[model samples]
Target: MKRKRTISLNSSSITTRSKTRAAAAAAAAKFYLPDDCWESVFKFVINDKSKFKNRRYLNSLSLVSKQFLSITNSLNLSLTIYNGSRPFLRRLFQRFTNLTSLDLTWYDRDLNKLLCQISRFPLNLTTLTSLTCSRVDSLRSGDMCLIADCFPNLQLLDLSYCSYVSEEGILQVLRRCCKLRHLNLANCSKIELHGMNFEVPNLEVLNLSRTSVDDETLYMISQSCRGLLQLLLRSCYVTERGVNYVIENCTQLREINLRGCCKVHASFVASMLLSRPSLREIIVPSLRHFSVTEREFFKRHICLVY
Candidate 1:
């Protein structure tokens, strides 16, 4: 009887140990990794060559756990929307509340409706620093004013190819968004600088490429944006006199793109290279009478892209 009782006790102990081992294995299989670990993994996954595949992986990760959803939301800093609907935009803003940069280039939608929807979410626009709404042809002065009102802390604004935005709209942005560091008004034909007196002291990079900007506009930019470093005036109406004015006033200018400016002579660019040691790049159209030696010398010091 004693031997049988001892065998039963030993068998019960063995069964308990096996159950504990099984429970430990199950717990290990369901272990949740830390958020930082998942973020590191996400970074690795996004480094893949295929963007679609990366997006798929990100979507899957977001659906895995609440922690993943939060990480994905914070990591999504820049977004590009093409012809987006109001409801879709609202959902995006709701998910990515900390979005810093947004690009709506070539959005073929109602400008007023989109702006109205964006205005409804002031919190989303408050943290936004960079905004690119290129080729928004319907963007008028009033629309620009609305943008300035909503996004007062905008540091970089690219309204390129927005031909409808007039001088008044441009002035409104410069005046309101005082923290603007980069402003692109490329192909904005109606933008004029006849009576503009406002200053953009922090403006470092300005792009007026393919615009109707004349010497007067250049002069205004030189006077107002004294800290101008990179200036793109490609296909603009600026003459050598205007370029000279910029070189004289914007002493900190590093790069200038004068491509397709037929009136700007290559000799003037060579002179600028000699005078402005800070000038690292000067992209001009092919020179007609530029000597090989002079070209080589300019190439050695600066990137003279033709």
Candidate 2:
């Protein structure tokens, strides 16, 4: 037997290599699941409860895995697109279906695509409550109607400095939004006294400072909105008649701003404030002197900061 065993170098080397290969295979087989099983391993990553830390983190996570990207992109809620972010806004509307609130303010007269995109919002018009439109000069009548029609449940509407909006556009909103309670039209140069005619039954607060409205509009408002509690009319064309109209009719009025209303007589305003104890704040340009009866009521809650 010993004489028959002839040791060959090639055969010996082959036997050694086989043992090493077997050991490596055994180690790899100890731990590892199939690809299908691995998918179910990270199921929590796709849940909507988990939110991205910040925008940078969101961008980074979107690149991590397909499941993460799908969930993150589907959960976008509030979106704000500034002047240069129009492209982002367009693409966002196309994909982001869960948008609840949107705020857009542009620097230039460029809202062609932005306005068009807003018309396609998926949610019911009655669900939206907040809106802020600024500096879209070419906005037409139809555009205003489209907006008012969409947000039938709008509670707060701020159209500050929207120069294109006329009486027609505003009337569309007043007619539709019965739930509207707060409205701000400061610096809206095109808005005249005629535009002030709105029947906001639930309206408790209003800001019409720096508009073209005069005492005639104020009188009309008192006759219409008896529930109006607070009104701001600084720097508009007003006189004693306007102030008198408000105090006589709008007894619920708690605060008013008459700053820079040079046409009004300070003495009359001082008298009205004393007569109406409900008047809490009266902002006037100047109050040189007051009658004894006026001083007693005026000093109650008058803040003459102007």
Indicate which candidate wins on lDDT: 1
Expressed as tens digits, the lDDT of each residue in 14-38 for candidate 1 is 9999999999999967896777887
lDDT of 1: 0.82
TM-score of each: 0.83, 0.66
Model 2, residue 202: what's the lDDT? Answer: 76
Candidate 2 lDDT tens digits, 1-306:
554454565677788899889887888687645544543443344444433344444566668777556555655555567777765655676555555556655535445455666567564444457777765566656766877766778777777777877768777877788888777888887676565565667777778888888888788778767677888888888888777887888777788888778887665665666656577777765656556665655555563323
Give Cα-based local distance difference scores for all models: 0.82, 0.68
Q: Could you say which candidate leads in TM-score?
A: 1
Worst 10 residues of 1 by lDDT: 282-291
